[model samples]
Target: MAKKDKADKKGGKKDKAARKKDAEREVVNGVFAPLVTQTARSLRTLLSRDLADCGLYAGQDGVIQALAGEDGLTPGALAQKLGVKAPTMTRTIGRMEAQGFVERRADTLDHRLTKVFLTDGGRASLERIAAAAEACEREALHGLSGKEVKTLLRLLLTVEENLQSAIGKR
Candidate 1:
């Protein structure tokens, strides 16, 4: 009887593990996560290739664009706007400063606060960045019609909202 009970417990454990795996499979296969991940990877690859000529990476252009819209933004503010951590922003800003793309200036009102400003080089490179981005988008959406593009945008926004809600729960 003891041996039979031990076997039953082992079978129960196996059943539990199988149930967990089924749940995981449902999450992975049903969630569109793989599609989203692959699409993101493909877009990043295309963007990297296009931006190579300008000597800027995929994420750096965002900073340039942000600065173009609102110059003299603090590092913390830029980090938050870009959805990046402070250290990562600091490293990127440091690299941009070294490459003469941006400069750090001490705020007049608050000497402790440093603001980032785009240099002449950064402003000049904006055209190239814009061209590269346009080319990448055009290539990615080569076959999509205007209406299809709009539909795709709507669907993607919906997906983003769904994911945002899921993240909020966490």
Candidate 2:
């Protein structure tokens, strides 16, 4: 019975070790989903830190860029354009308003509806935010050549389409 107990303990330890290795292997190469998610999260953290110097958050830059292309969009319209939820867009816009980066205007046709516009500060901040974004991209792709960057972008877009298709099927 003593020998059997010892053997069982050894087997249990081996099983645990094997499970740990499997988890590690999964993260390393088993599936692309975990890798893609980790890459996205890491990139967001890096970009957020860099954007902080410009007084903007990671996701806020996208909103600014969208607004820059077309100003005075309703909150819902902006949310749809950015692919963000309505509540999230509202919170972001509220923060930007508090920071003096955006302002809300009553829609001329409908007083009840509000539209978002970039404030003077927001227009000026665009240059800095753009530079920060470029710098972050350069840093992230420091070792990659132009061809490699293009390849990476193409691969990412393909992955995005695959995921979108999967979501649509669901």
Candidate 3:
């Protein structure tokens, strides 16, 4: 009976240690996800302010840059390139068209299809957009060394890939 009581005590200690480790892991995971999310939100807010000076929004810059690279792309293609849904792309295009930044045209080859083209205003804003993005990046990386920046980028890419893989599995 004495030996059995000692064994139970040892097992309880192991269980307590395991629970402590699990709680630590949970705390780390909880902090990590919120930190990443808050960082992203803060960066977007900063970038949005900079972009506002250039008469653009946070997301509109991506569309402008994409259209600058490929002059005419369908809304569906743009959605795929930007990793957004088709409806969202369509609404963005509509807003941009209203703002005179982009215009939709019937595809020359396929009349049934519509392609989005950057307007003269959009073309002219490209330089300011680039400058805004650069400023945002500089502010974000203000205190980080090049090595630190590279490591951060690598780690973020790994995290993104892991999340994407999990999403794909789902």
Candidate 4:
């Protein structure tokens, strides 16, 4: 296992001890996890509803958002940006191309290299979709205090960074 993964596992001791002080703590009751399912479902459901006019899915939004800043990217680059398998990226791009979200063309500098770029529709959809996502996140964090939200975001970002660093080693 990677050093980061080892460190991630190392935190269990602290977490276990911290929870031991509580007289009663909430427990999940599912084959999967309530926390995981709730957030995932909420994001997907909200995005689907809010972005319906945009003609995009929750998974496809990442590519559009990435292309919004950068003019174009190679399949390998897109895969990295989305943190997905190369084959999965290929399929997603193929579907997006069919949907006219993105287009592919041979690179001018390297004829063999094909790059992906967003269509005008893709660009327009992204701005609204992003706003919708921001709203969704705002709603999700509504009950939490500012400090609690910041801490939660910090912890989630740490986990993302740690796993990303470990993934790069592979």
Candidate 5:
């Protein structure tokens, strides 16, 4: 009777949760996912903690933020800024419209385009979302000073740009 390899043993699909946990460990245990996952989940947790009562989900808050920044943007333009496709942005915007957070008007200049606007309720939500997001950032970057935070942000952005450049070449 030979012992089974840990990888093979773990590979057996016991249940969704078990499989998910295993996969997470593989991807996240060491450094890559730990940092990313912690950063992401913490943000979500903090945002939810501060914002769930206000009825904003992670993605929806983003849409609200975008609308608040620019009062009248086409769904296509919103999609580009949010890094999503037009179809996806359309769906998100539709939901927001239903929720009374946004209003869409047909573009007078371009009837084919629908412009998105934040309502009064939507503007208030933006304030909440911004506060929640900032709270999460403060929580996540607990030790860094102002200058350290600035330097870290610059370095992280540079890394993101370099990664994008490499990806583009490939």
Candidate 6:
């Protein structure tokens, strides 16, 4: 009976050790999500400060950049491209219009469709916006080597694609 009791004690210890190891492994594996979230928050804060100097907000930069790529996009198209809702895009466009950065006009051929175009002031801000984004990226990648930066970008893209696929599944 004593021998049986000793065997049970040894088995219990092994079980506890195995459980501890699994917990540690899970903690290590779980760090990816939090780290990515924290990094995104930090990057947004940095970019926001830089963007503020250009007389723009964090999200406003994306709108400007998208317009620069292809001018005269509809608010709905902008919303879809920016991954925002229509109302949010409308408010953003209204604020930009008020700021003299963008203007809305009816499409010539299809007057019913409203198109957003960059105003003269918005076109002038392009350089400053580019500089601000460059500065933000520079600060974010200060220590990393070129290769490391490329690898990080690749991994992030892969992760993003995986997440997008998962979202589509749901």
lDDT, candidate 3, 5-32, per-residue tens? 9999999999999999999998897699
Candidate 1 wrongly placed segments (more than 4 Å) = 1-31
Each prediction's whole-model lDDT (CA): 0.92, 0.89, 0.94, 0.83, 0.83, 0.93
Pick out the ten consecutive residues of candidate 2 with the lowest summed lDDT: 26-35
Winner on TM-score (3 vs 4): 3
For model 4, residues 1-170, the per-residue Cα lDDT tens digits are 69888788779867877786552343333433567678879878987778766777667888888888786799889899888988999898999899988999999999999999999878877778878899888887889999999898898788679878999999
Best by TM-score: 6
Candidate 6, after superposition: displacement of residue 158 in Å?
1.0
Error of 3 at 65 (Å): 1.0
Q: What is the TM-score of each candidate against the true structure?
A: 0.80, 0.79, 0.82, 0.71, 0.72, 0.83
Off by over 4 Å in 4: 1-34, 162-170
- Indicate the residue-level lDDT of 31 in model 4: 32
Q: Model 2, stretches more than 4 Å misplaced?
A: 1-29
Output the worst ten-in-a-row residue range by lDDT, candidate 4: 23-32
Off by over 4 Å in 3: 1-26
Candidate 1 per-residue lDDT over residues 1-170, each given as its tens digit: 99999999999999999999999998878568778889889988888888877888768898999999999999999999999999999999999999888999999999999999999999998999889889989988999999999999999999899989999999
Residue by residue across 35-154, what tens digits does model 6's lDDT show?
999999998998899878878976988898899999999999999999999999999999999999999999999999999999989988889888887888999999999999999999
Q: What is the TM-score (0 to 1) of candidate 5?
A: 0.72
- Best-to-worst ranking by TM-score: 6, 3, 1, 2, 5, 4
Best of the candidates, lDDT: 3
